[model samples]
Target: MFIAGDGAGIGGAKAAALAGKIAALDIACDLDRLTAGDRNAAARPLRRRLVKERAARPFIDSAYPPYAAALAPQDATIVCRCEEVTAGDIRHMAGLGCLGPNQTKAFGRAGMGPCQGRYCGLTVTHLLSEANGLSPDQTGHYRIRPPIKPVTLAEIAAMAAPEAIEKSKRSNVSTQVNG
Candidate 1:
């Protein structure tokens, strides 16, 4: 659901909380029964009373400041390693009539990469917001395209054979000519 990113930008806190809950709970729940249609089915068989477990105390270690990456660096440092798009590059797009992340992406390939903007989307949004004098929400992040099916290494290797590729190409050419 949070493909573009959560509002806080970092989802580590939620992951950390889930980890804490899993560690604390001693319930012997079967893994397979956990599904949308039958959530808590395994737990239901146990029928153990589940009182509201108080959330663990918030972890506080002032030793390091909480997430400072997004706080600063209004500099021209390269943000999108995939596209080599810098903060200045994003701002320049803004100055050149690019209002939001999508526009910048279309204009300069800022978020178009193998990583699919996972690494640089947050930074691009920040830069766009600052440049356009709008909030991050206003200069929204890129919309997620539908996910393609994942392929295994073995599947890729099988497709790499030259004879297979040539056969496929010949079929494609024949179909095109007939059509």
Candidate 2:
């Protein structure tokens, strides 16, 4: 049975677990020929255990990607709101021999993703640097912007008129300070 997951390999885990159950039922779970056209073949006992065993690590590790590979470089988008950039745009710019974080930001908007590149900046820099054959450090720092998320005009107005809004800056500051 096919399963979908967060792309962290959860599907492989589930397949392993299911294979365990199938092994218990069928008593034959050989996995030797389980690849490619072998999936349609009868389950062998050893194959079931192997499937379960093989699936465990991927399942557990599926929680997150390796540090070396943050998101699926190709699959993951490159736009950074903090930088306001997209991956494709970054690649295109990189192809033009652009380098450095500041340069990348200026050209590709690396730190402009919706999460302000808090989620994607470093990873993007790494990928871009690798593609460009530049040192990661050369990928200059991204622009540090305020209010990463979009604050509506109404919200700004409320903040401006704290007395009218009742949630004054003092209260906000006090909450933050106290917390």
Candidate 3:
């Protein structure tokens, strides 16, 4: 799996686009869709542009560092607003031997809320790492399941249509008969 763009630590839209192109070229080469020489030829310009795009990142980051307060919120500060999980709650979980965000879910439904872990995952990890005296990498992230997108009641109801219900019944009957 190739992680380009911000995931690869190349920030900004231009840099991300360039990194994506480079990653695509590399993947194509790996799949033999493009020869190594051809891939290199195609990626040279993209790499140069990506370097230029990333040049300003240091300056931008220095100008606007991450919010320090977020890294170390007050005990009562709600880290996971969706589930109303507080920093103190996360620390408490750590004290109880919760080593990571995924484990914290079993202790308290922090990242299991509607937004999943999008907004709070980082904070949760940071808090857990601090409390457990481990690096964020060691603290780990959420075990992302399906339905990544928010499903409305109407969408769910649509899935329960007569045809789908019939399919479900047939599948269940098939499973039972096979068993």
Candidate 4:
């Protein structure tokens, strides 16, 4: 491969042939009129801006004021029901003994609420994890069962035949057998 660039426009044939073998190509008409240092200095600001914007923002739960406030107040109206657990309550439970979401729920009644912790489960886990000194992953998310939102017996009756309803009940039971 050969590259010869002088006054006249860079020869396209030569450029195409050397393209693959070239490691870096700088095109500057009147190349000798400007020094390499001058070009590099001009690129500094662009390089700086790229570096500044490349950083990632922290996770929502990690930086939000509401999250910090929630952790500070236990009786704070826990937003989710499935997990009757509150940040403050979990903190209290952690002080007592249990250190995990499952244990905390079992003994403290946290995350066991009606909503089943769906809305507040993650928040509760985040708070409990911090309070109990557990990892976020260790808090383990809640088991989302069928009919995540409660359905009334009447609703089930209206939707299915008696046998179907009974089968649903059995299936629901089987679904949660290990849960």
TM-score of each: 0.49, 0.37, 0.68, 0.39
Model 4 Cα lDDT, one tens digit per residue, 1-179: 22333212223444333332221223431355446776456545544543343333234334654546554455656544554445567667767876666666676766566655656666767766877678879867666454456889989777768788799999999989967
Model 4 regions lying over 4 Å from their true place = 1-67, 71-86, 148-179
Which candidate ranks first by lDDT, i.e. highest? Answer: 3
* Strongest candidate by TM-score: 3
lDDT of 3 by residue, 1-179 (tens): 78787767848887888888999999999999999999999999888888888988899889997697897799999999999999999999999999999987899999988777878998999999999899989989876665457889998899779888899999999999998
**Candidate ordering by lDDT (highest first):** 3, 1, 2, 4
RMSD of each: 10.5, 17.3, 8.4, 22.8
Candidate 2 local distance difference test against the native? 0.59
Candidate 3 colliding pairs, count: 0
Model 3 weakest 10-residue run by lDDT: 142-151
Better of 3 and 4 by lDDT: 3
Better of 3 and 4 by TM-score: 3
- Candidate 3: stretches off by over 4 Å: 141-179
Give per-residue CA lDDT, model 1, range 1-179, as digits (tens).
Answer: 22222332333555444433432232222344345335344334332322122122232334544355663355668878888887778888988989887787788998887777877887788778888899989988887555587889998898778788899999999999998
CA displacement after TM-score superposition, residue 108 of candidate 1 (Å): 0.3
lDDT of each: 0.64, 0.59, 0.89, 0.57
lDDT of model 2 at residue 61?
71
Worst 10-residue lDDT window for candidate 1 reads 48-57
Model 4, residue 44: C-alpha shift (Å): 43
